[model samples]
Target: MIDFYFSKDQGVKVTTVNWRIHKLAQEGVITRISRGEFTLGSGISYSPSLSNKQISLYRKLKTEFPFLSICIWDTSIINEFMLHQPGRFYNLVEVEKEGMESLFYFLKGKNMSVYLDPSPELIRRYLSDEKDPWIVKLLITESPTQEVNGINTVTLEKILVDIFCDELLFDAQQGSEMDRIFKEAFEKYAISESKMLRYASRRRKKQELEIYLNDISKYRQQPNFIANK
Candidate 1:
């Protein structure tokens, strides 16, 4: 049956096979131990069932959406780790979205650790610290606003305000770090004072607008005088 469904050169209706396999698993005829890419059951272990083509597609999607975050779903088991370690896996609980079903499917097979919902305070602390701009960008862009298991998306203005507020408490080194991140974000995201103010006005925080206006002037006037070789 497995060979009939999964033969490399054969044409088989994947949906039909998937449904049949799922039903059998649920009925105790087989055990499902992983995501769509792999499965294991009594007296059988499927080794690397996903095709090389599918693996290539997955990598393409991940590369294209580098800012895509798994934390936005309020999954209690989700945790962020250093990007250097590809071997690590983390389970994210409380994910209800259909899109996340794929992520959960992959993580379950890897047997990774899970972390609970991160507090707003912790997120705020990270924003202030300027330690991880990629993370900050992901949080602002991907967090859902209002829905079951939704993550709250921060406005662009709010992001600026948060960074500014954090910088007030920073020392020299921290200030340099903030400068580096802000410059990078500004260049990468094409951020401008006008764009920031537009978001700030919607939130009814004119004070924030005033601060940004001041900062923008200072940022613009800094001599771009690069020494020529």
Candidate 2:
């Protein structure tokens, strides 16, 4: 683990240290494994490294709204879990509730393919064939995320929760495909069920999701699979 210490002789304030830590995390110089804790190495996980354009947009928006939480990721990441591949992928930008409207308008005025919490109808009408459609939504509470290459992106846990709960938004990753995703994700990455369940509880789906996950575990012939892993 990378331990961060503040020194008074160097005249570093707590806020300065905090900002620097966030900066280093954004640049992948360090990794935030949990709240107020960091470690070295890339570690096994699912997190997208944003493209330059995506990072630039995030930086600009963050500067405009410093206190707002933001997360961006490409839909291409979902292709791995999709049985029927989507022709065009989207760039989703999720922001805090209070900043959603303002940011959406600002991005729209700038001629970006920006939309505010697109519905299934709107997605089919405008975003289906568009190249890199930028969809913005209000960030859900307790959503898990990771910073990669100076930008915040959704973590695997968040992705799994979304795939399970959001049928409209993540329609492509359903039924048997959902099973495949869960199986592949657990096998390929080191997932924290505690973190996932905490976030799912915030979404009010913890019990049901837990039941579903347990069923999947039993089906896989690995009872108490996730917690044990």
Candidate 3:
């Protein structure tokens, strides 16, 4: 719209107009949704509350292995979008494959309840019995993540994709509950379809996830960004 108006009205050079657009976004006059999608308003980015336990875990792992790529978050973050809150919750610690085993054992040496990519059977038998256990998995490259108080953790895009991709881990959040979660997330946050689909592709569920998203389309309403535009 800026490009169209400026070219028709002022005949301004495209480069100068592009710079103005960048500055607008930097000054919070507009929000960038994806590569070329802009929305009006200050973006409502997701920033989960991190507990002292989560902070200590990241700090300890970083101190031990300074080069490891780690992302940590408590499952309770989902309660923000859920209508029926579950009583039990756990922590997810995703690390790069090379450091996964080493990190698991490091935490286990201190008697931390941890699991490394457990199966459905393992979930039903073991993880079900423990409260607040940490489930460590191999963090895929290019997965959407963010930093909270200097500790890495999953983004809203990754959380939505993971809920669809991992049935065993997110069983409590499945079925109609899952539908509600997706609807609430899209309504409340500035999610990038590009980032989500890229992560879904990494998990090999891009096509199936696309279908599910369409099924919930009727429940979603595009925000009225013109209020701030």
Candidate 4:
């Protein structure tokens, strides 16, 4: 007999181990991908970085939204800011959802954007909040009409609004982070006060709109700021 579960001081006969592996293979949980090499079946894939539970959740989400494009933000940022855990989560962005199923699917799991770059705990907390499901759904589905450096990014103004919205829904720390991002985006991207105002107007977030407008107004003396608008 060989130990199957070491902590339990339990051992399984070779026949038992073979039977279990065979049953799992039959059920498509495991497969022989190549000669002498075993692999997870169609329902599974190997991700040395993710835990079994995380992999299962990822597969389920992928199965539910086959058409959605998936991206993972830098794990270090997520660990430092969002989860505070040294790992990553799938950030699913869908551009073709026409119903509630997509939203429901995302809501069932913790989702974040490359922009949020929050810690895992924060991501989980945000997902669990009853008032934020629609907000998160909108964030996932919303796409920029353009891409920057080969990665899709929301417009600077829209990003600002997202941060402000997060602030409104959560706490000051999130809001400050959004403010920092807004400032950084303005410096790096071709953002204009008019464009920012337009985006804010479309969202009907008047207060945040006014705040951005004021920020731009104060910076009008700067040449880059003038050139941008």
Best by lDDT: 3
lDDT of 1 by residue, 1-229 (tens): 4454766536767777778877976876544333332222242311112234334433543564444443322111111211122222211222324434455445434443222233457545553443322111122332222222133223323444444543332222134444554443433332334444444455455576566555644443222211111
Task: State the weakest 10-residue window (summed lDDT) of model 1.
Answer: 74-83
Task: Write the candidate numbers in order of decreasing lDDT.
Answer: 3, 2, 4, 1
For all predicted structures, in order, the TM-scores are: 0.28, 0.74, 0.84, 0.40
Give model 2's TM-score versus the native structure.
0.74
**Residue by residue across 104-215, what tens digits does model 2's lDDT show?**
9989989987889988899778776678788888798768988887688898889888788877777667888888888877666656676778889988899988999878
Clashes of 3: 0
Kindly report which residue pairs in candidate 1 clash with one another. 77-115, 144-151
**For model 4, how does the per-residue alpha-carbon lDDT over 1-229 read when each residue is reduced to its tens digit?**
0242233444656677667667876997655433323434342321213334334544565576665543212112222222223222333332343533554546545553222334557656664343312222343433333343333334434444545554533343254454454554444433445545555555576666776657645533332231220
Every candidate's lDDT: 0.37, 0.75, 0.83, 0.42
- Please identify model 4 stretches exceeding 4 Å from their true place: 1-97, 103-136, 139-144, 148-153, 168-179, 206-208, 226-229
Q: Please identify model 2 stretches exceeding 4 Å from their true place.
A: 1-43, 82-84, 218-229
Count of backbone clashes for each model? Answer: 2, 1, 0, 7
Question: What is the Å distance of residue 116 in model 3 from its true position?
Answer: 1.8
Which RMSD values do the candidates have, in order? 22.7, 11.5, 4.7, 23.2
Error of 4 at 149 (Å): 7.6
Regions more than 4 Å wrong, model 1: 1-110, 113-116, 120-174, 183-189, 198-206, 209-213, 221-229
Q: Which runs in model 3 stand beyond 4 Å of their true positions?
A: 1-30, 224-229
Clash pairs of candidate 3? none
